[model samples]
Structure formats: structure tokens, C-alpha cells
Target: MVLNELGARINSALQALSKEPVIDDKAVDALLREICGALLESDVNVRLVHNLRQNVKKRVNLDELAASGNKRKVIQLAVFDELCSLVDPGVQPWKPRKGKPNVVMFVGLQGSGKTTSCTKLAAYYKRKGLKVGLVCADTFRAGAFDQLKQNAARAHIPYYGSYAEADPVQIAMDGVAQFKGSKFELIIVDTSGRHKQETELFAEMEQIAAAIKPDNTIFVMDGTIGQAADAQARAFKESVDIGSIIITKMDGHAKGGGAISAVAATGSPIEFIGTGEHVHDLDPFSARPFVSKMLGMGDISGLVETVKDMQLEKNEDMMKNLAKGVFTLKDMRDQLQTILKMGPLNKLMGMVPGMSPEMMQGFDADESTRRLRSYMSVFDSMTEAELNSDGKLFDTESRLRRVARGSGVRPVEIQALLHQHQQFGQIVKKMGGPKGMLGKMNPGMMQQMAKNPGAMNPNMLKQMGGMGGIQNMMKQMGGMGGIQNMMKQMMGGGDGPGGPGGMGNMQDMMAQMMNGMGGMGGLGGLGGMGGMGGGRR
Candidate 1:
């Protein structure tokens, strides 16, 4: 029934051609018409879609497929491949070199999150333990300084913006100079958003770049703009060395593909993406997933990346625990916590192949994750033997009693966790890590995760089993617990380069995850939730 969409769309257009082997002018025209409608409805750029149709018509050998009785099937594959090629599978937003202090210059129409992103970038770099500096060069807007200043405060980094300075370029120059010889390894300039007419402002930005000679220049655009992305990206590209782009407001945009597709022509890679106004809402942009969705295909690579990036340095602990073939109540707690770090689990799951959108429509992703997290908290209250060793929680009576006395949760919740862990055990047992840690991990991201901590779920932590809980956790981990324990819990079993112990503690993970997610100012929903783990909902 489901294949009917792609199947039916193809068949309806092929009826006349299917009856005859050679698809002449009429049949070819008909097939193109069907595809054109589908592409246009999906919010694809009209001219782009038209161009694609022309290419497909010229290339596809309709007569051969019709003769083989597989015209529709062959046609679908061709359309899919062409569409995929159009999207460009592996375009990353921004991947600055290790030691290069990437100067990601932010640009957008007014109120598209430039100031917010600047602080987020500063925090991202800071968490990486890189010396980070901020330049509030957006002197044009009424309250740009106040806005950017507020964000800088959230990140707890230094910033230079002058109300009297008037010249944005000068402010950037001063900001760049102030951090010289200091710890900050990365410098982000928060420039004011302007219209195409502002050539003077563009020249000023050139002056700033000439002064700083930034490693990367990022263009921040609102995700809601769709096809207009062409004009916006072009305007910025004309003025300076626009190296990358960031698409913001993704959490709310309904027709976001235009903005997603428009920048391909600019020769500028989209580096960071903003989902919301929150600082942690920023993520490195990858084009594969966005492209796959447009063609109605699943995006497996994004899932792999999210899982690899989400787990900080602690997935090793999970692997080690799994390798030992052990699953404790504590391990269950940690597993659930790890899932939180892995992010809105179901959404991440949706990126996997065969994960149907219709299937997701039935199951509420956020609510289910919340239920699972609560179950994990309940399991956390059990004794060491109950958590670590087998048979301690074997009896249903013990499970019920443990649930009631410890986390104020129900027995049913505990039952579910144990059941799920059993399933997980079976799954892990079947998996063979071909490259082992090298197979499952992203080296750069893993390194960053080791340094950054997940955000705090104030309400969850406050309500779940109470104060000094983190202290208790630290004690259980024997003083080394805190973040290292969490990271070990994250990457414990993995043989990745980012294995723990080298990772410092919560302070580091916090800075890093904050910087990676959206830093202090962008701690909204899943962004900050990535760090909260046990505290996260």
C-alpha cells in the first residue's frame, strides 16, 4: 500500500507508454508532466525541477524499460538518482581545520539569529577548550550591541562592540586585537544584517577580514526563506569571501527546501545550522539528509553521524558494558541517559533507512523519550547489586517495591526498561563492529564530545531523587565519576581515539556540548537536552 505513492505516481503516467514499447513525443511528455507536478508540490525550485525533468527525459531510455516490463521501476530509480545527484550527497556545513581559528562571519536579514549565533560559535570554540573571542561588529541595528552583549555574557566570553565606535570594521579590528596572544583560538565576528544596497557595509566587512584574515567566513540565513536562498546567499557572496552558510529557524519552517537548495550555486558551503533561537540549537549542516527527504528516500548517514556525535566520549563505557555482556539497572539508567545524549531518539531513528514517516506519525517521539527517561530514573535508585549484577531485580515483587520506594514511579515502568535492555542486549550481541571504535565513531566529533558535557534538565534533576545526587553519583564513580564517568559511560567500550580519562570533567563537556549545541544562549529543548543526560528529559 505504501509503495503505492511512488509506484502509483509512476504507473499513472506510464499507462499509454506501457502499452507500447517505444515512448515517443506524447508518452515522454506525459511522464515528465507527472514528475514535474510531484517535484513542484514538494516545494522544489520550479526552474531547477524543470531542468531536472529535461535531463531525465533526454537520458532515460523509456523504450528499453517498457520492452522489459519494468518501465516504472527503472524510471523511479533514474528519477531518484538524478534527484539525489541534484542534492549533492555529502556537502558539510563547515569543517575548519584543527589548529585554524575559523573566523565564521555571520550574516542574515535582520533578526535571523546572527547575534545569537556569534555567541553560540564562541561557546562552541570555548568548549573545545580553544581560546574564543567575540566581535559585536553589528553597530547598525538599534540594539545590536545589547543583543550580542547579552549573548556573549551567556557564553561567559570576551566581546568588543562600541556604541560610539560607529564603524563596525573598527570594532571587529579591536575585538580581533584584544584577544591576540591570549587563549582564544577562534574569533567570530557578529556583523549586522543588511540589504544588497549596503555596499559600504560590505566594504567595511572586507576591511575587517583584511585585518583579521579569518580562516572561514560563514553566511547565516533563515531556513524559512526557501527558494529565496539564491538571492540572499548571492548578496553576501558578492561582498566578501563567503566560505559557508548557516540556515536558521529550521524547527518551525514548513517549506524549508528552497533555502536549503538555493545556496548550492554560491560555491559557499553551509557550515552551521540554527534550529531555534537557543544557543545550543546550532548544528553542523549536512546536505545529505535534506536532499534524501526531498526525493522521498531515507537518510542513513545522518543517523550514523548523530549517534557518533551525540554520545560525547562516553559511548566507550556503553560498549565496554555491552562487551562484558552485562546490563545493570545502573547500566539501564546510563543507557537511557546515553540515549538522551544521542538526542530525540526517535527523530534520530527516523534518519535510518526503512524508518517510515507514517510510522513516526503514530508514535509521539518526545513523549515516549520522556517516559523512557522517567523509567531510567526509577531504576537508578536500586542498590549496586541490583543495578550491576544479575538476578538482583529478577523477581517482579522486588522490581515493584524498588520502583515504589525509590523514584516515585510505577512498577510497569521498571518492567519496560528491563525488557528494553534485554532487547538491546540481543541487538548489540548480533552487531559486529567491523572497524570497532573506528567504525562507529567520528574522530573530530568524539574529541569534541569528550570535552563538552550534556546540558542539565533542571526540572528532571531537581525532581528526580533530589540534591547532592550528582555528588552521590560522583562518589559511586569514585571521585573520577562526574564527567569522566559519564563519558566512560558514553564511550566506555569503544576503541575510538576519544576514549575517556583524557576528557577532564563535567565543566569541559558542558562547555563543549554548549558550544556544539548552541552554547549558553541557545539551550532550548534538544539542544541543551543533549548535555542534561540523567537531568535531561
Candidate 2:
């Protein structure tokens, strides 16, 4: 089964239990059975799934819990904890420190995406302000160095390799020495991908490791390997320390459950997962958040981290205009650009509280990306005055036609862009007036709000339609259960009544939470832009 389908099945079983009028052992057993079945079908190890079942049963005493009430909550929590345990080995993965060279070695079977993942990891660290370098030590595979070179060049990361250096060990040592001497903070050595039966290659791997003494050795496992991932992980772990694992090809219809479950065999944490082929497709993996997103609960913390990593809050002009309720076309364009930078649309949607994978089924990520790019093209063709203006300059047919001609976009598409900008402008207008939420807040509070929307006070809650209003909105979103719990966790309520800050921060929080989400394609507006014809030039 696909990973999303596995999540959906497990979620469906949980939802079924939630609907039960009476909590009973039979219902709990049914839920566990369904969940276990999903895991097994997804190629997860049977032993792990069985242990998960027994563990949940041990934690939840439905009979005793019946006396205390909230039986469902106890059972749900138990399941969540057990699922988290399946992937977490209780060992913290190695981390690279600045001002020193952190050597990271890559090892995996050929075709497990080891080379690609090396570049992705380098790119990920580079994005975080680390001076990273790549060393291709895979002399066994033809074009491996070229692949790394092209990928490194495209990502603008420094690299070290040689066509004449047939000795992989020498290459690894020379590369590490070169980068370390150059003061690169993170030096990643990509080793030749080998099989378990390749004794000489395994010996060479150990030699390379001994030569460089890497701080962290990541085992790149193919998600599609299914149950075989367990043996492969064990094999690689035996060969090296296997400080961490990075599962690749997760974006495809791979049996990711097996790869995730394989973490138990190696006793290493999954440092990252490659979601796609893009240089920015790597996601830092945390077990709880991974399962939460898989189960459609969303990862608010991950979303917050992504936003902070992008430093979206540094746009002082946009923040000032937002405070004054004056959103211009330029601001809208800037948002679209940020969204494009934030990675795939489906990935962003998964970080939202209510956007389940099932809900995302109809949204084509490629189409949405194309539409966003076309909108950008439309903005690109506009004059400086029009871009800085409130988009009303396009009211004249002549101006619209001229822009349409220049941008190769239909006039209607430009009109659609204007309409979307107008909607955002209206929302901004509501935020700035004397009676508006921003108007009531001081500059310090506004800055705090931007930094953490979940920290809003009760007065701010009243400004945004109250707790009831937020719950109603979440319900209207998809009728998916557990949104309230998700919201509470997002707000750092930690099992409090009505969550932290009374749900007042939901609207303004979501608005400021993911500037990319609110600003990108205007939430639902991107879907309505059918074809976005003639805007591709």
C-alpha cells in the first residue's frame, strides 16, 4: 500500500472508533486490528506491528478507563505514542557544528538514491547557512562523480572529486582534507553504493571510514524495498556505525512503512527523508510529526520551522503595510514568490491542521505550481506603477490588453489575479482599522504576534470570531475529526480545555503562521484558476 493510503486506513479505523457510542474492548481490538493490517500491508515488519498492538493494549485498560471516562482519548494517546516508538530508537542522531568540519559519510546499496540524497543533504545544510562541501568517492559507478558534480554545481555547493583518482579511499581522504583545510563546516563524502555480498567493497567502505573518521555515517535506504529494508539496514549497520538513516523515494508510491520501521533494526534515527527530486525536497524527520502528518494531523512545528528558516518575517516593508492594512500588488507578488520558495504545495498543505492527504487528492501540485508561476509572469509583465498600485490600474481595458499582450496571458487571467489581490486587500483592510485587531495591538505585541501567533491573548481571540467561531470554521473545512486536538497542540495548549489562547489566534495565527499559505495563491483561489491559459512564456 502507498504510505498515504496506509495513513488513511489507520485514520479511518480511528474515526470508526471515535463514532462508537460505547467504548468497549471489542471496539478497541477492532481498531488495533485495522491499524495492524494497514501496517502489514504497507510491508512493515510483522514483529513491530505485533509489538505495537500489544503495547497499546497494555497501556489502555478500557474496563478501568470506563470508570474514569475519556477512554477514547487514553486509547488514542497510547496508539500515537506506540507509533512514535516504532520509528524512534531513543538515540539522538549526530549533528554538525559550525566553526569546525563535520565529516558525514553516505553508504547504501546501489540505486538507493545515495548520490542524490548526498546533494539534497548538502543543499539542506547550505540553506541553513552552513558552508557545506561534497566529495564523490564512488569510483565503482561510472558517471557518479559527474552526477555529484552537476548536482553540486546546480546547488552551488563546493565539491571535490577526480576522474583519474581510481582509489575511492584516497578520493575520500583527499576530499575531506581539502574541504576541512578550506574551513567548510560540513563535508559530506558520498561513497560507492554497494551490496551486502560485495565483500571487497564493504572492506573498502571500512577503509574509507577509517581514513576520514566521519562524525556521522548516513545509510540511505530505498523506501520501495519494503520488508527487505530491515535486512538491508541491518547489513549496513553491521558494516558501519550507521549513525543515521535517510529514506529516499518517499514521494513515490513506495512502501515507506517498511523503510520507517527498519529504523528499529539499525537502532539509528531517521535524520531526513527525501520527499522529491528537487534540491530542497529533503525534510528533517521527527517521528511524532512524521506520523502526525501521515495520519492527517499536520505538523505545525515543522511549518513554523520552515517559515523561520525562510526568514519570511524579515520583510519589514510587507509587515508594516500589513499593520497599516495596505496590501499592494507588489506585496502579493512577493508572497507568490515566497510560496514558490517554500517547496511543493502538497507539502505545505500537509503542514496545515485540516488539510488531510485525502483532502489533497484533488489538488495537483504541478498544476498549482504552474499556475503560481504564470501569475508571477503576469506580475512580471506589469509596469512598476501597476505592481506597486492596488491593481486598480488594470481597470482600463487598454492597460489590461497591453499587459496581456506583453505577458502572453489572457486578459481574464490578469483579471483573476486582480480579483485575488482585491480579496487579500480587503482582509488587510480589516486588520488595520481602529476597530481592527492590528489597530488594538502595540508594535511589540504585533511583532510578538508575527513571531508566534499562538501566543495571542483573549482580547485578540475576540477580534478573530471567538473559540466557537474557530471550531466552526475547522469543522466546515473537511469535517475531519481531531482538528480540535490538533489545533490545541498547535497552540501549545497541551490538553487544556478549549486549547491555549481560546482559539482566538486561529484566524490571525493561520494568516501570519504560513505567510506562504495565506499569500501564495490565496488559499482556494489557485484551484479555481483553470488552465491559466497563455501565461507560460
Worst 10 residues of 2 by lDDT: 528-537
Off by over 4 Å in 2: 442-537
TM-score computed on alpha carbons, candidate 1: 0.67
Q: In each prediction, how many residue pairs overlap at the backbone (N, C-alpha, C within less than 3 A)?
A: 44, 1
lDDT of 2 by residue, 1-537 (tens): 148888888879888988999988889999999999989999999999999999999999876886876888788878878888888898888899988889999999999999999999999988889999999999999999999999999999999999998999999999999998999999999999898889999999999999999999999988888888888788888989999999889888766788987799999999998888899888988877787778877676666567656665467667667657788888877776776898986787676655556776655567656655766787898889998899878778999999888887777667656765676578678655565444554555455545553354666556545655344433433223333334434344321222222212222223333432322212221111111110110
Local accuracy by lDDT, each model = 0.54, 0.74
Worst 10 residues of 1 by lDDT: 528-537
lDDT of 1 by residue, 398-439 (tens): 556755578866555455445544544443333213322212
